[model samples]
Target: MALEFSPETYKKFEETVNRYPKKEAALLPVLCLAQKEFGHLGQEAIEYVARLMEQSPARVCGVVSFYTMLNTKPIGWHHIQVCRTLPCALRGAERLTSFISKTLGIEVGQTTADGRFTLSEVECLASCGTAPMMQINDDYYENLTDEKVTEVLASLK
Candidate 1:
């Protein structure tokens, strides 16, 4: 079977496309909408977006690969992304990541056995001032200590 957006989402997709001068210029946002609709940009979703955007699947895949924000595969419910840039590193992001790994019993790029969490190390998230921060799903937790991380995790649980 082929993949497609829901009626409401299709309306949103049309509006998004209309906002851009060229349909191709809407590729990124369209892909985002697809990702939200499908949960992740698997091959079928990529092809669907490509057809909708009037681009080739390879081109759509290339764009998906270029952006870390776009997920090509399924991720756990709580996507924990740790900042590993210089500022974050200086602020003990590495240690924080290790703590999270040990706490979650999962390594970087790996999801928990229960599929509750996925740990990832990413580049700057534009929170340099709040170095040593991590993004859980859509929320950011900053200025973390081991105790604070524990509290955050417990709260999530």
Candidate 2:
């Protein structure tokens, strides 16, 4: 089926649009709704959102490419994002990421064969104090050790 939001999502989108003085201001939230419905914002979805917002496809694509939170391709069910910023790096985030890659048998930016997890090396998760953290889907697992990371992955499985 073609990518489109549900009727309920359209209602939410309308409400979001009303919240903003300009329809362009609603682009991000509408794009978010489109992504949630379609799982990823491919070319089709990007253009769809652009037309809905009365904006150019290039403009929409630019926004999608600029944001780390936005994805242009399919990701696994559990998107594991490891923070590699200065604070996280100082706290062994790289080692932790390596451990996860080894454990999952998939390198960063690759999804596992089973389609259960996608590992991504991201910039920062804003958890500087709780460094060495990886976000699984929406939940953050912090202060990771090999054993703890293993336990977390096993629990998800």
Candidate 3:
């Protein structure tokens, strides 16, 4: 189906278009807005954003695939990003990843079968002092113990 924009969305698009002198220059912001609105940029959404920006899907897809923040598929209700940098890894990120994998019964880069959680081993999140930390969606959790992580997971449901 061809994509349709609501009045409010059209207004936002207008704003974005104004932010940059050229329509092609607003592609990233448009894609980011779609991610915020739709959670992730699937093929349809990517193409829609490309059309809105007068760009090709291949160009948009290239950007999406290059950036880890731009997810191509639907994630779980809770997206967990475990820091795997030097500090976090030294503090037991491997064990923690194993623990989460066992608990969620899903490996890294995979969401739970029921689609409630996703585990991803990410690079430094700029929280080196708080080694062994993770970010759930947009919130950061630091100084994690297995018990603490388990409790947090239990509370999500």
Top lDDT: which candidate number?
1
Using TM-score as the yardstick, the better of models 2 and 3 is 2
For model 3, the stretches where C-alpha displacement exceeds 4 angstroms are 20-25
Candidate structures ordered by lDDT, highest first: 1, 2, 3
The weakest ten consecutive residues by lDDT in model 3 span 1-10
Clashing pairs in 1: none
lDDT of 1 by residue, 20-51 (tens): 99999999999999988998999999999998
TM-score of each prediction: 0.95, 0.94, 0.85
Q: Judged by lDDT relative to the true structure, which candidate is superior, 2 or 3?
A: 2
Clashing pairs in 2: none
- lDDT, candidate 2, 51-105, per-residue tens: 8899999999999998777889999999989899999999899999999999999
lDDT of 3 by residue, 1-157 (tens): 5655667877888899899978888888877778877789999888888888888899999998886667888999999999998999999998999999999999999999899999898889999998999999889999999999999999996
Number of backbone-clashing residue pairs for each candidate, in the order shown: 0, 0, 0
